[model samples]
Target: MSATHARKKPFLRLATAAVAMVAALGMAACSGGASTSSSSSSSAQVGDRSPEQIKEAGEIVIGIFSDKAPFGYIDADGKPAGYDVVYGDRIAADLGVTAKYVPVDAAARTEVLASNKVDITLANFTVTPERAEKVDFANPYFKVSLGVVSPTSAEITDVSQLAGKTLIVTKGTTAEAYFEANHPEVKLQKYDQYSDAYQALEDGRGDAFSTDNTEVIAWAIQHPGFSVGIKSLGETSYIAAAVKKGNTALLDWLNNQLVELGQENFFHKDYEQTLAPVYGDAATPDDLVVEGGVDTTSTN
Candidate 1:
C-alpha cells in the first residue's frame, strides 16, 4: 500500500514560511549549468555588493521557506525552524551581523536574489543549467533527487505511470519545471504552498505530487495515508546557497563559510537538530549532505 520503501530512502530530505510577501515567481526559461556538483562561479553578472557594503548594512537578508517543515517552516512558537533557517543564522553570525529571515516560496528563490530583495537563498535552492544563468550558486551543501507522493489508493508506482495524470506541485518548484520540460504528457496542478499541494493530492484534485525525494519521504512518514512511491524521478542534485548574479564577494564569502563550517561538521549537527526529528534514523548526514561545497556522497 506504500509507495516508497522506507528501508531504502533516497538522498535529499525536506519543507518552509512567509515574511514580507512579494510577488510570486513566474515560470521562465532557464539556461543550465552543472546540477549539484562542487562547481561554482568565480564572478557575478549583477548585484555585486562589496563586503564593506554588506558589513555596513548590519544585517544580511536571507530568503528561506516559511511553510515546508523540518527543512524550513514556522514552528509552534511562531519562529523559523528548519535546516535552512539554522544556516541563515550562522551565516549572519559569521559576518557579525543580524540575520534577517525573508520568507520565500520555491519560485521566488531566484527573483528575490536577482532583484536584490534578499542577499541569498538557502531555501533548498537546487543547482541546474537553466538556473545557473540567473544567479551564482555557491558550493552545494546538500544532495537530493526527485520523488513522487501519492495516496495508497492510487497505486502509482513510478513516474512513468504518471503519464496523463495530473500531479500537484508547489509553484516555482523544480518539480513543475522538470515535468514541464521532460514529461510534457504529465499534467501539473501547481499550488503556491506545499500544504496546498498536499491538500490537492488528498482532495482528489491530482493523482499525485512530486518534489525533492528527501522531503516527500519525510512527508509520507508524517502523514500516514500518503506514500512516496517514486523514489527518484531524475538525477541526484545538490542544494546550494545562491546569491545575486555577479555578487562574487558574497558568493566567495558564502563558499568560504561552507568550507570552514564543514571542518566542524556543523551541517551534521544541523541535521541532528532539525531533520532527525522528522526522519528519525532514516536519513544520515552522509546520505544527503554535501560538505565543503563538494559532493561527499561517493566517499562517505
Candidate 2:
C-alpha cells in the first residue's frame, strides 16, 4: 500500500481501539477491588511505616535509562533528567529517602529487579501479559503506542507496507514480537540499543525503524530529514514501574502513589515540562496527557 493509504487505514483502526480501551479502563476503575499483584507478601508490613523503614536505610536505589530521553537520560551536566527521573524523585521524596539512580538497559531491567540491584524500576517498561507473569507492575502511569519511522525519502507508511522490507528494532522490545506474530514476512534487524537501531536506520541499514510512537517521534524530531510515517499502531499500553515478584507491599505503595499523582495531573504536567519541547503541539492525545488516575487491574 502507498504511504497515504497506509496512514489513513491504521489511524482509523487505532481510533476504534482507543475508544474501547478507554471505556474498559474506566469501568475497571469504578468497580474497584481489581486484582492486586500476587507478589504481595503475607508477612509484609504496610502503611506509611514502610517508606519510613526505607528512609532509615538512608537511600533508595532506582533503575532508569541512561540514554532514553524525555523518559530517562543523563543530561549534559552528568545528572539524570527526564519524566521517569522526575517521577522517581517524587517517589523517593515521598518515601523520605535519598534517591540514587542506577542506569539500566532494555535487557537488564528484569534481572536488576530480580537480583535486587535496584529498589524500584522506573524504566519505560510496558505492561504486558508475559512480563506481568514474571515481575509485578505498578499502576499505569504513561500510555504509548508503537510507531513506524523512516527517512523522508522512503515511501513506506504502514505495517503491511513493510511486508518484504527490512525493519530495525531494539532487541527484546514488544515491537519485535508484534511484527514476528503479525507480519512475519517483514525482515527484521535487531539491535541492543535505541541509538544503534536508529543509527542503523539513518545509515540505510534498514528501510524503517519501529518502537513506541513516543520514542520514535522524539527521535525523528531530533533528526532533520527523518519522519515518523505511521504515528500509532494497535493498542499499546501504559508504562509502569516493576518490582521483584513477592513484593506486594512495595507494589501497593507504588499503585496508590500513581493514583494520587494522577489526581493532581502530575503526568500531564510531566509531559508539558519534559516531552512537549520535542513533540510540539500535536504530539500526544489530549485524553492521555490529561487522564487522571487509571485503573490498576489485571483485566483488559
Candidate 3:
C-alpha cells in the first residue's frame, strides 16, 4: 500500500474501535437504566388500596366530618363519635381491620379519596352526578334534603326572603350548588367548615344557613334561638360511602356491607345511639335513615 493509504488505515481502525467502545457503553447504560426503572415501578405503591390490602394492613382509613354533629363529629372524649362513626366502626370490624378516622372538609371529600388519603368517605356525602364522576358511591345509607335555618327573631321561611339577604352555606355542599343554580339572585356567604358556617349565621353575618335537613334540624334542636324554617329544599338526596373511582373491590364491599347491616337494622340502631340524644322528637329513622340501601319514601 502507498505510505499515505497505510497511515490512513490504522487511523480509521482506531476510530472504528473507539466508536464501537462508546456504542457498547451507551447500550449497557441504557439497559441498566431500563432494568432499574422497571424494578422500581413494580415495587412502588400507588392508587387506592384494595379491600384485601386494607384488611391485610390491619387498618382502613375513613374520612368523616369532625364538626357535623349527629352525622360525624369529634365528641367530648376527643374521639370520633356520631352516626357515621358508629357505622364506620362496624365497617372496619366487618372488614377485619381497624378504622382510622381522618377529618375531611366539605370540598375535600372527593379529593381525599382520589389522593388515596382515605379508603372510604362516610361524611354524609350527598350523592350527586358531578361527584360520581370523580368517585364511586356505595349504595346510600341515609337520606337527606336541604334545610335552611335562621334566627328565631328573623326566620326565613321561604326562598323569596333570601333574594337580597346573604345566605350562609358550607362550600362544596349540595345546598351551595342548589342555590347557585336556581337562585343566583340570592347572595351566599360560604364557609369551608360547617362550624364556621353556623358561626356566621349566629353572628348575623348572614340571614340564614342551609345544609342537610337532618343536620340543620339536629343543630336547631340543640341551639335554643335557631329554627329550621325550610325543612326540605331541592330534591331529596341520599348520603353514602364513597371510594376512589375504579376501586371496585372496596365499593362492592361497602354495598354488600350495607345490605348485610340492613338485615340487623344496623343504621336504626346507629340512629338511636348517636342521633337520638340530639334529635329526640325532631327526627325519626324513617325520615333520615335508609335501610338496606332501599328508599322507602316511594312506598311510604
lDDT of 2 by residue, 59-82 (tens): 566787766775776654446678
Candidate 3 local Cα displacement, residue 25, angstroms: 54
- Per-model TM-score on C-alpha atoms: 0.83, 0.79, 0.84
Tell me the spans in candidate 2 whose CA falls farther than 4 Å from its real position.
1-50, 285-287, 290-292, 295-300
Local accuracy of candidate 3 as per-residue lDDT tens digits, 36-76 = 33443343222376777766666677888877776776554
Query: All candidates' lDDT scores?
Result: 0.74, 0.71, 0.79
Say which candidate scores most in lDDT: 3
Worst 10 residues of 1 by lDDT: 25-34
How far is 160's C-alpha from truth in model 2 (Å)?
1.9
Clashes of each: 23, 1, 0
Task: Give one digit per residue, the lDDT tens place, for model 1 in 1-300.
Answer: 243344223212222122222222111101111121112222322245555565655656678777676787765445666899899889888888766667777887899887766778889988998899999999988999899989988758877898988988888878888898899989888888776787678788999999998888887877767878887878888899998888888888888888999899888899888888668766777888877777855655
lDDT of prediction 1: 0.74
Error of 2 at 223 (Å): 1.2
- What TM-score should be assigned to candidate 1? 0.83
Q: After superposition, how far is residue 55 of candidate 3 from its true place, in Å?
A: 1.0
Clashing pairs in 2: 40-248
Q: How are the candidates ranked when ordered by TM-score, highest leading? A: 3, 1, 2
What is the descending lDDT order? 3, 1, 2
